[model samples]
Target chain A: MNDSVIHIEGLHKSYETSAGLFPVLKEVSLHITRGEFVAVMGPSGSGKSTFMNILGCLDHPSAGSYRLDGHDVATLDKDALALLRNRTIGFVFQGFNLLPRMSLQDNVALPLIYCGVERAERHQRARELLVKVGLEKYFDSMPNKISGGQQQRVAIARALINRPSLILADEPTGNLDSHTSTEIMALFESLNREGITIVLVTHELDVAQHAQRQVHFLDGRIVNDHATLHTEASL
Target chain B: MKLAMLGEAWRAMGANRMRTFLTMLGMVIGVGAVVLMMSVGQGAQYSIKQTISAMGSNLFVLLSGSSSTGGVRSGSGGSYTLNVADAEAIAELPGVQAIAPIHPGSAQIVYGPNNWNTSIIGTTPGYLDARSWPVASGNTFTDSDVRSATRVALIGKTAAQNLFGDADPVGQTIRIRQSPFVILGLLSTKGQGMDGRDQDDTIIIPLTTAQRQVFGSQFPGSVRMVMVQTTTQEIMPSVEKSMTELLRQRHRIREGLDDDFSLRNLTAVADSAAEATRVMSLLLGAIASVSLLVGGIGIMNIMLVSVTERTREIGIRMAIGARQRDILLQFLLEAIIISVIGCFIGLLLGIGGALLVELLTGTKVIIALSSVIVAFGVAATVGIFFGYYPARKAAQLDPIEALRYQ
Candidate 1:
């Protein structure tokens, strides 16, 4: 019951510049159990984007021992890493990167298609996810043709299509108005309460308040980790 | 995966109608020109060959005015050069089928009230067999008529129509240059010659009659040229060689000196014409194919731009679970679709062009099914050659960076 979904030990990353190799993350280590709701908060240059990239399997650390769902990600080849990412991780970007040409339903069905799901079943699953994300009315609406809040809702629906073990949202509500951001955060809280592990990267304190645990970072090192007392753990 | 990718390709091309059409225009014109030119050229070749073959394959014309080499004219003014003796000598050679000594000139013929200017060819009895002339109404002149200089004539269909329109004019009298001659027969229609000359606009007569009455030839043994027919096509070379040797020795021409008379082998002339046409067709086809290559490059250029434009879309698909091969196949399919559509349009346009030329110019055009197959195959190959680079680029794009694209 104590299976670690994501584990990192002594992870470090740096960017080679004209000046030198400026380090982004310095020996960062963390672990999250299955179905845990974890939120990360930091200032602008705290290396949270790089950390989210590694956690989402979009990139690998320069030097680290990192494992996701028990697979060693640092040792995997690019194609293999892509497969691992597709199977175990789902991503929600701040931009709500739904294909501008496709409808909301098609955007949701994209992940299922990559997962090799049958066409009819993929459509059925996408429809169910759209309804769950309160976008049943806009199933056929294109991303560009919809409001910003509706587009983000469709993006969240797309992230759940493959039924991945981990949901990685990089500032999922960063582009939304305050009311829409609160609504999206509540939706993420409800999904977390339903036994889905949520790892979110954010700079907004109000958005991070919905998480059960918040880890603060400064200069690429964890400065504090604490549970909020006002919000009781539901699961 | 293939079907899905093909669907995506169809969708992509459909979304950008004008760009897709412009890209395919080069291929269309290339294939269209190749088909049209080849079809028309082959058609003309076939038509000419058929006309020449109909004129009798056995006939070889001997011209005395100009020698075959260097366009050299041997004698100054010609009158009564060839005679019955030379015709007999050609007839006596091995592989010789028949020989006709000819003296041809234009003259005005008047029959009753109608007057027509037509060619007058004076020949012996052998001219009928050598030229494959069929007597449609009356009898050909006998050897006695030629030897005795009797004034008898055989008129062709055109001459018959002009002089004796809708009348049975056999055994009637026609005056050639104020000399009266009896019409012995009517020659059958021979249609037009290979060089577009009217074969039926002539009157045939005994060589002696033409020499004595029509042309007023004072010289005894002279004619314009001699016509020879070989027994078989295979032995024409031997007959030609012996005839040339005999004529050269008769004319006292030494080695390395061009002969005084040119031997016109109909088969050789036909072959050269065919070869010239074949080479012309090949040159035209090669020039037209450059557009096809250009069209292939256009496909590659457009596909590369498409990959760059859809970088994030590709990244999202990759992140979701699509493999590198999937992205590669998608773009490759798009290129192939464009080429295939272009090929179809080109095929139609090419056939239409050929048919239009045939109708407007009165030229026969043949459309071979193999041209369609070849056009399609060439287009598909072009697709593969041009599609590789763009497809590979799509496959090599980094998903992480692509997903971050704004």
Candidate 2:
């Protein structure tokens, strides 16, 4: 428990619709240890996306105690939660949410701006990350001027700019082709080997195979949790 | 961090240059009109003050009674009911500082070949002291000159310019009404009178010289009008009352009979004129401020649209850990930048417009630095006041819902 990066017990979330209180997640509990890659699998209405939002600290659980990197997320105020998110978690979305008006370099340096980094150091770090992601030539290019794969690379670079302890991705390759998706998964695999914990949501079996462990959700409840057979066999 | 956010804001505003300029147009016109109107109004007030000061302070003009000849009555100052003796008596009163008895007329003035028609003021040496006027060159005519009824005169600037050109008029002789009078000194210029008359286009000579030698007064020692200066403004009413009573006694006027002279408070009339100009200046500024209000509203309107259009960008920043204050400051800075920049351009335009007005219409326009600072300060405040609501709305957006916005 002390080494765990995320620890949730009896997490429950609900929405108040016109029909009344509609529960999305019910009595679900999970834990993710450091340096581990976990994939969450579920259908569209199985509460997996809500679970991802909670883990990212973007939304509050209706009735649950959530601990992220040993901080009680439910107990923290808005500003404290923002600071925690800045320091501990990085998010990559399916839409590659890069601000369109900013250059690729500025988009990658966005998180560092929140961290109060100086402009020179921000540029230096962003340059290094862009070089690492094979986007060394597109530093000043606007986001719309770049391809989808290159834009996703910039988003990943932004997620890593703050040196977060955990990376949370929601269907990161949902809009990418198969070849591009494989290349992005390879980047994630390499990042995991570097000892950064990663949690991802995906319905594709092939994408789930990239993670060491898989958790399946059904009807807002966890139905299975186990190591991937490929990983087990390799071990 | 703030500098970085400002850069981001600049880029965001640059993204829609047309909309930004259109929004700033309102501020541009607002500040421009305010500055121009303030300058013109202040210029008018300034000129009025100059005229009042040139006329002298705490002054009164005592006009002789109108003359009735066969049921056709002439206006006030038509008869010789006021005299030098009455002026001397008024000078003995408590608040009387100085007195000058005047017999004024207009005649053709000739110096060599140059001739001009100008008004003439025949008064004692006390007239200079009462008007607070100084000689620009040479000495003033002495009391002995008045006693001797000498034909020595002081030439005003416009009279000197017309007769002497650039040459000094002192020691020169000018002919007034075909009589030679030596120019003893030059009176300093007093640009214009309250009645739009050229005050500097006149000449002053001794009262005894005019009454005895020039105009030939029907009643010896009597004058048409008397100019009285009071020690302070507060004692004017008492002095006026005393002068009236003393004059009536001297003239042997019966009870319930009208006085032979009437007094006019020049200071009160000038004060009212100044007050009217002040009110006009305020009204002009008030009318211009309406446009400023509209400009602020325009900024608010555009900011609301920008906030709605960039909802997803706000969510992206929030997801990367931007606080509410960060988002608020960003949008607020954009609004302020627009207004301040627009104000700068408007300041230049206003000053240029004032100069153009002065050049074309020959009207005075005073562009005071304090007014410029006030306009700039008000514009910045309007930007902040109107920008707050939209910025707060952007800051309070839910990151989850904002991210999902199309």
> For candidate 1, lDDT tens digit of each residue in B326-360?
78888888888888888889889999999999999
Model 2, A1-235: lDDT tens digits are: 6689999999999999999999999999998999999999999999999999899889999998889999999899988888877889999999999998788999999888887999999999999999988899999999999888888999999999999989999999999999999899999999999998999999999999999999999999999999888865654
TM-score list, all predictions: 0.82, 0.95
Error of 2 at B190 (Å): 2.1
Estimate, for each residue in B1-406, the C-alpha lDDT of model 2 and write its tens digit. Answer: 9999999889999999999999998898889888998999999999888899899988999999999999989989998898899999989999999999999987888999999998889998888888889899988998899989999999999999999999999999999878899999999988889999998999999999988877788999999999999999999999989989999999899999999888999999999999999999989999998998899999999999999999999998999898888999999999999999988888888888888999999888999998799889989998999998999999999999999999
Best by DockQ: 2
Question: What does candidate 1 score in Cα RMSD to the true structure?
Answer: 4.7
Fnat, model 1, is: 0.40
Write down the C-alpha DockQ for each prediction.
0.41, 0.73
Predictions in order: lDDT: 0.83, 0.92
Candidate 2 CA-lDDT value: 0.92
Cα DockQ of the candidate 2 complex: 0.73
Docking class of 1: acceptable
- For residue A108, model 2's alpha carbon misses the true position, in angstroms, by 1.0
Per-candidate fnat, comma-separated: 0.40, 0.60
TM-score of chain B of each: 0.81, 0.93
